[model samples]
Target: MSVKRHAFVTEENSISCSQTEQTTVQKTETGSKFTCQQCGRSFAAKGNLKVHMRVHTGERPYSCAQCGTSFTRKGSLNAHMRTHPGESPYICKLCEKSFSRKESLKAHMRRHAGVKPFTCVQCGNNFTRKESLKYHMRIHTREKRFKCRQCGTSFSDKNHLKDHVMTHAGETPFMCDHCGKTCSNKANLEIHRRIHTGEKPFTCPQCGKSFTAKGNLQTHIRIHTGEKPYTCARCEKSFTYQRDLKRHDSDPFNCALCNKNFLLPTHLRIHLRRHAYARPYFCSLCGKSFRWLGSLKWHQKVCICAKTLLPEF
Candidate 1:
């Protein structure tokens, strides 16, 4: 049998003998082909070696016009352009759901077909995708690939690392349109927007009461479950939330304006309001103002005082 050989493509996409000479190819007993010069990964053909070289070289020739995201292959760039227009060419016949890429449709089809090909040898757990299995295997091996540039904290996944870095930087990318509030993540902002939209997605199974956030739903479920995650160190009393636990602590945080101490920082903030001269809330009836809403409501009911009142909040 004649041994099949092909010329390797250069960085410029031209087949060059000099580029092929850079890499060494050794055939194994099973007829393995080309090996990587850097990583020692074996490839069947010289063309595949040329494509795989981009991984080590960080060479991305293909780019999308919409987002300007570069890709190693031209096919990846073409698929990325479909995402800009929200165009899904591949449609599943089972549910008539659309996907931008064929691979996504295939993954979706696996969910309906109940097919899990990727399996972990150690745990014997099955996953729908290979990447899911790879992530799961990190638990057994304790492999952390992603590292923070700022804090030097390592994470197994990129998403967790991104979340950790946000705490260090105090970066709030997601913003609310109504209240001008900002959040570190999109999910938190989405939950905050529910306060305005009144859209409750998380529902309690026991009481049928709905909440804007899943955390709130989980906390509600804890009422039925009787699960108290937070506890006081001194009293050994349990609470549902951290705020409730802090509330039980007597006089921890102190007011900067006054010498009086409070359990919570929020109580200190309310105490500091009494020292401020600015009474922002104006009464239309008396043309007078007050600092606290409770004082204003009290003034509206009983007091016909002509002067502005800065009551002790």
Candidate 2:
């Protein structure tokens, strides 16, 4: 008989994804005393067997107070709580970067170590994390396990299915403080906040330039590597960024702040800056200020008063 003793470790300030961690079970010489009714798995302790039954019953007893999201384990709830305030306690030793969860830090460590532990047997694809490998396996298996009860739509992951169902529900749970705009997910809200905060954390490896999102950094990295990852589904045309792909298809990216449309999200982000009072460029001769770099460059060439600033450049 195996007696699994549950040990709960809580982070001091931040929320972690790991919840209700169970340590190595203490195996006894005595025969199995506790047996799970659903799976017929025997355990030494009745409490261990009871918690294990949640797998069969699909019961998430613990829930977040702020988001009203439920979790099967207490540790998951602990981790989910950190997302609300954006507190990340888990930090990487090499780069000293803090992550919202320990698992995320562990995954980030792979990038520094160049570790590819998980491999796909079917396609020889390698991934840093096990969950990513499992996600990749769906490509080979064509597994759409997360089925939507409302519609006939299915997804490879639970979160994807959850997001798909929200489209039908039309519920915008996450909202922006600055623009009062709303989104379906918390991640989107975080990305939107970067516009107001002007926080660009993701930096280019080749260049010292930074961006608000990792996706933007990836697109910028493609510029150095000459990697065109985005492809048009209609004509099979490739693009370095998704915004370029949309632009090639004549799709306009619209700004919510002003009813004006642009070709890229970067353009929309820049367009949003017009709504805010941000003057980073200055003309030495006229003491004139501009919000954008292009405007200042044009002023240097066209404006006679901007002649003195050319020496600084």
lDDT tens digits, residues 146-200, model 1? 9865567799988777566566545555689999998756667898999999999
Give the worst 10-residue stretch by lDDT in candidate 1.
Answer: 7-16
Off by over 4 Å in 1: 1-81, 84-86, 166-171, 178-181, 184-188, 191-313
- Window of ten residues with lowest summed lDDT in model 2: 6-15
TM-score attained by model 1? 0.37
The TM-scores of all predictions, comma-separated, are: 0.37, 0.42
List all candidate RMSDs to the true structure.
Answer: 15.4, 20.0
Report the C-alpha lDDT of model 2 over 57-162, residue by residue, as the tens digit. Answer: 5577999988798766898788788776557888788988888978899999998999999987754657799998888677545578998655778888887776
Best by TM-score: 2
